[model samples]
Target: MVQEKQSDRQQRLDNFLQAVEAAQKVQDDIMKYGLEAAHLYCDDIDGDWLETWEEDEDGQQSFVELVTNFLQSDDLVAVKVRKQLKDKSLQEIAVNLEKCLSLSEEDDRIFAVKKVLLRGVAVAESNRGTSSDEIDEIELLDLAEELLDKLAEFLVSINR
Candidate 1:
């Protein structure tokens, strides 16, 4: 039982790290390519994810369909959320943003399902939450880092 628990924690850690790296790439892509290219990126923050998926075949190509669906679905959701926040008050804005987090959880679960199908293990942490809209690049990056920190903490607790 102990061994199984440790293994689960390790798997979750690996998955979390991979996601953080992916999120970081998304941020960098937006910063480097500008938001205009975001469409080319298929809703990947700026365009980092699309570039990574296209250029990096280390293990992503095999899951092209999965990644594409995740990106596009997420991007579509982002577009809608951006529109809804146009008239919300400060408090309402926060609530509306929280409604947008289904995509993140969707992305994570899709990745985890793929991993489980291939490796017989589900490593992705199932987390879901919403966020505010029109968040600038720096804010997006900070949010990404905050998520990474939170995931790492989850990993630590699971390890025990």
Candidate 2:
């Protein structure tokens, strides 16, 4: 009985360690990419912009062959960097919003609030017809700061 209990504890510990490692890897990817990742999360566009579709008459190409052909034709490096950027940005927004709301990371409302803030950014910049990704570094910094300030104010007012 003691051995069985020990084995169960060991399994739980191993599962926890695996979870930590996975989270660390995700954090590393986000750090390498930046907040651009968050902007992409709110974007309505599909990442399939890089894909090409062809009608196969006989469908002679096996799935593996089609995958190989696609991989050979696609600029995987660029796509990866773009996807990573989106993830990083999303992480940044999640962290900041969590701080702003004094909420835990696991709170589901964080996702909804992040989307609302991104919409605010879009509405503010709609006059220029430029998306957040198109904004230069300085502009992005200023815009982010401004959005956060406004959000803080809005949050404060609702508590009154």
| Over 4 Å off, model 1 | 43-160
Clashes in model 1: which pairs? 97-131, 98-130, 98-131
What TM value does model 2 have?
Answer: 0.25
| Per-candidate clash tally | 3, 7
Candidate 2: worst 10 consecutive residues by lDDT?
77-86
Candidate 2 structure quality by residue, lDDT tens digits, 50-101 = 3333324443433333323332343443232223233334435444444545
lDDT of 2: 0.48
Candidates' TM-scores?
Answer: 0.26, 0.25
Off by over 4 Å in 2: 35-160
> Number of clashing pairs, model 1?
3
**Candidate number of the best TM-score:** 1
Task: Look at candidate 2 and give me any clashing residue pairs.
Answer: 35-89, 37-85, 37-86, 37-87, 37-89, 38-89, 38-90
